[model samples]
Target: MNKNKALFTLTLVFALLFVWTVAEAGSSKRRGTAGAMELLIPIGSRNLAMGGSDIAGVSGVEAGYWNPAGLSQINNRVEALFSYQRWIGDINTVYAGVVAQLGRIGSLGFNLSSLDFGEINVTTTDAPDGTGETYTPQYLTLGVTYSKEMTDRINFGATIKLISESIMRQSASGLAFDAGVQYSMMDEKLRLGIAVRNVGTNMRFDGPDLEIKVQPPGTEPGAAQRPFRVPLQEFELPAQVELGLAHDVVASESIVWTVSGSFLHNNFSFDEYKLGTEFVLNEMFAVRGGYVLAQDPDEDTFYSLSEDFIFGPSFGFGLNYPLNATTHLKLDYAYRMTKFFDSHQLFTLSLGF
Candidate 1:
């Protein structure tokens, strides 16, 4: 098909999907009802510092999480990234991803993330203090992504992810899918991105831990007890649709300044708005800052009270150094403001070849 015709068809498809997903989005009434929240956690330090507002401009391996479509923008033939985050409640998160470009075809990426909750003492109804036993909870996700440049300015991508969670003897597993598209205009100075994330099957926990010994109410004194299995309810995964726009306000040889913003339509919680800015110097040093705000149901204003949100402003910096003619290394750090807990910190390292 012609370029214009293809763009028109892609836009129509995205609009239809947006309408269908938004129709199912839940308001405040459905908050806290979703399962496998680990899918919503942000990964790379650069994007996290931008409050996840760079969906349109993000590129390379790091784009696997923010917007898979951006993976098509990888400059090198191969890229690798690793990141570590100190999340709230003493939890630690580790993420790693790699992307490779295929000549005349597309880009492919793979990523893995895990959460460390540490060990906690086991407690039961009879033992209020502790049971002298400790168990660690495991949360993990693995994803495979494929992205391609449909036209000079249009890119499309999709990802399939496996989500797994285990606590003690009980465990749950499910699958999720993500898709996104990015369009560039104004001589590549303006960009727009749309994505749908974490839409998948419901998950329920089941294992030996759910079985218990019980007796019939009207049974005789010597009657034998029976093993009963507790029934569990399945929960839906958190789903959201994101729309973003980015523009290069100042583009020059030595300095480039870009501003980006996005709106999130959440299925299980309040909607959110994010704004971020990045300043690059000589293609080696960069600084970024961002702010996130949620919608308020009680008030008619555009944003809710800042105190009601868990995460607020964020800032970070990055350094890019060339290793050789065809290799480069990047180091990044980010800090985020939080309420009722220690602030979040992250470190990331990336290599391109």
Candidate 2:
């Protein structure tokens, strides 16, 4: 059948991409060079609870951030979600999204993610102690996504996001794109997903903060101060590609279990491997856990735990309640173990109608 051919083509493409990602995973020279690091942070609580391994199984409005191809799984007419995270360093992230079905054509999604850095005392070369002034930094991203089921076994989607960051007066803005594909086989028992994220143009900060009023050297004492603008170096976006696989190990009326694994190839950092598991009881409650290996698992030990910044293990749970035949409420929470400071927690509320 024609649909079978399409599925085969998509599968081949995804496999090639996965191979390429693994081939380049050895490059560790680009660390910290890329800007827009916020793009690398995982967004959805459900997705995070699954240890960022939901590319093959994510659905609904939350898929706007994880893997848009899964948006096609939204069977309801409309869906909405709100999430909050008390991230590292007392930073807070707020997220919201809405998705709507478009007849038989496809699904459309809109989502916003904002990082609140709170207020910090202003410091300068002259005033290292304190300037008695405070300012907040903002990192925001607004995205629009479209997804469609190409066939019974294949789905495709894309997202275009506007990214903006501002600190006091200096600000920089840029655009990025995300594309993904999902394939299911063997009566939906097996799933594969591939996505390329944060592909965009270079960006640099420019504003009044970079402008300085200073006197030219060797000038007369009464010489007027000239305005000098410090040029900021442009940086590339933190682009990466992800490959994920998930399988329904067991499916029944009262209990279900799914296992997933993912490979992340970061252009700005070391590659990572993640394994996650989820157990659902009566289709109303779920528990999850995962382990992440940063580059080499053998090197990950208590001796080097303090030197490394990335976390390793995580655990979480979720609860779902049905309001009606066409509506339901879902709540999810996750806790991530870290090497330094404190662990991270996330909470999310989702509604379907």
Candidate 3:
């Protein structure tokens, strides 16, 4: 009887989340208005390999970025992950995280992600021809997460993240919060997850780059210059909500198969749908595939492919090796197809102890 009640409650929560997502959908206003947009980029190769559809099924350290609620399922005492991404436009990213169990209390996680934009020539109004100087833009994020199993079938988690963006002498910093819930039903074969991310302060650029020495309008050429600073505009963070569902098709001693789907609601951009599937053999080897769909597009444009930009199909593979009774290593790789430029590739390694 209790099991039935629990299932009923879970269904009700899912329904409410779905309705809330739909109510906020189809608003194209304020597109590209958000700053620190990099936060919207998905992390964790294992989750990305599954087409960024692991919001309901992620486990351990990867949960810090995908769905913190999944961190409650950390079976191991300690889990760590290191990932490298070859992003678009020759940019590179390094992501790392660790989650440690806190006995009966909960799980604590620390994550760090950094992006290197490489060196580029700095140009100014007077140096449009050539600046002869170069500068590198850097993006970094740090997060602390916590998760606990509220009940046998329910989990809750939250994250506090700090974002930093720097270029030459100018930089901006802000904080954001993420909260998520996960519900498991039907003997843990069905999973549902809801997460709201990047809810916090707005960001704007500042620093020495904004300062300039200017002469008064009536002053002569040799007159002393006064210091003036450019006023920067504040922009909202990339806030979004996600609803994901996953079901185990085959749960056996030696083989397991799963299928998952997710809906993303963006406050400043178009909505997206993700579908993914994974097959595992003896929990050692796996293969996965996924596709992304854009909800709206400019049909009048000649190049409209459903109004999609870079999101297309994605595929990946994984391997898991157990070194000892209490230790294991895992590797994951993913390929994301794009409409322009080169495709993105991610490689990740994880250790469990």
Clashes of each: 0, 0, 0
Listed in order, each prediction's TM-score against the native is 0.97, 0.92, 0.90
> What digit string (tens of lDDT, one per residue) describes model 1 on residues 98-173?
9999976999999999999999999989997889999999999999999999999999889999999999999999
What are the lDDT figures for the candidates, one per model? 0.89, 0.83, 0.83
Candidate with the larger lDDT of 1 and 3 = 1
Best by lDDT: 1
| Model 3, span 1-353: residue lDDT tens | 77557556755765675576456443546667788988876787767877788698888888888788888787679999999988878888899999999988999999999998988987889998668989889899999999988778888789999999998988999999887888887998999988878878988898987888999799888999999999999988877788899999999999899999998777777677888999999989999998877665323222212334566788899999999999999999999887665788999999999
Model 2 / residue 271 / CA error / Å: 0.6
Q: Which sequence of candidate numbers ranks them by lDDT, best first?
A: 1, 2, 3
- Model 3, residue 130: distance off in Å is 3.0
- In model 1, residue pairs whose N, Cα or C atoms come closer than 3 Å (at least 3 residues apart or on different chains), thus clashing, are none
Per-residue error for 191 in candidate 2, Å, reads 0.6
Error of 3 at 149 (Å): 0.7
Worst 10 residues of 3 by lDDT: 297-306
Q: Measured by TM-score, how close is model 1 to the native structure?
A: 0.97
Residue by residue across 128-193, what tens digits does model 2's lDDT show? 987999999999999999999998888998999999999989999999988788888789989988
